[model samples]
Target: MNISENELKMMVLKACRGIGLPVAQAQEVAAAMAASPWALKQLLTQLAKPILTASFDFSIGLDIKNAHILRDFWACADAAYLASPRVCIRGVSSCDVTEALARYRGVSVVAQGEDLLVMVDERPMLKPARCEVAPDEWQQLETYAALTYVPETDASRLVGAGAGLTDND
Candidate 1:
């Protein structure tokens, strides 16, 4: 399926949020996915992994030994963007997604062994107007995004869900 960059971002944002990522982190992941739509598979993989708590230190950067890629990568990117010229993240399972995110954040990433070195050097790229996505991947993303929706119910309708009580107004 072919979708505009904005559409992809919104879908990814909803998917990330559906998986329980905080709004800010979800937005970051969405922007990264939009920047590199080809990384959708990696995004899905990362989403399926167990979410783990990350440890960060100004002096030590981010250590993701037991952490999931979705949240910790962005956190490390933010840290690199703000404080250090370069930050090292260990045990990154989704290098492609991490690289995409680093590009989105205008940072450079170099993988060394099982670790990633992110530096605040690169400039963010402009997103393409349209990108091709595998139909299966798009469907999977839709499935995840669907978790954000509220199921239709009579009570919800009365409260003004969808078209609410009337659409003629």
Candidate 2:
């Protein structure tokens, strides 16, 4: 079947996801493949190996949505993760990772399953680096995260746990 470059990256993404790699990692792998023929060939060879079940064990994770954020965060966090796998991130979600990276500095990003946790330092280098969202836009992001987040099988309730919350709550 014929495919476009974007489609090929998505296919690579799916393959990475199948192995329990988080969305950010899958995206990184797909992007690397798209950028270099040598990387693509190496990835294909690796994918061709005998099948084996393995758990996701990488220590650090990034949860970014777009290329700008991907590049920016990669520049910031790559060394930390490469040095050790114990760095943890506490963060929120946004459709624009590039904007987020540009706006926020001194933050850590962690991946838990398909989710990205954006952890901010207690004292950010820039005092007001966090993005300021309009009420409507903030609502939309919250709704999106709520819809996509899957509660565990053992969990008794949703995140709020019957806290009598509404979209505006």
lDDT of each: 0.78, 0.42
Displacement of residue 94 (Cα, Å) in model 1 is 5.8
lDDT of 2 by residue, 1-169 (tens): 2334565565556665554456786576555444332233334434333433322334454323322233234433554434443432223233333223423344455566544544444433323212223344333324433443456663555553666445663
Best model per lDDT:
1
Regions more than 4 Å wrong, model 1: 61-64, 83-86, 162-169
Task: Give the TM-score of each candidate.
Answer: 0.85, 0.30
In candidate 2, list every pair of residues with a backbone clash.
69-98, 90-118, 90-119, 91-118
lDDT of 2: 0.42
Task: Tally clashes: model 2.
Answer: 4
Total backbone collisions for each predicted model: 0, 4
Best by TM-score: 1
Pick out the ten consecutive residues of candidate 2 with the lowest summed lDDT: 125-134
Candidate 1 lDDT over residue span 1-169, tens digit each? 8799999999999998888888889998898888788788888988777777776656565444565667767767777778665577777643678778877888777777887777786575747467999999888888889999988887766776455455675
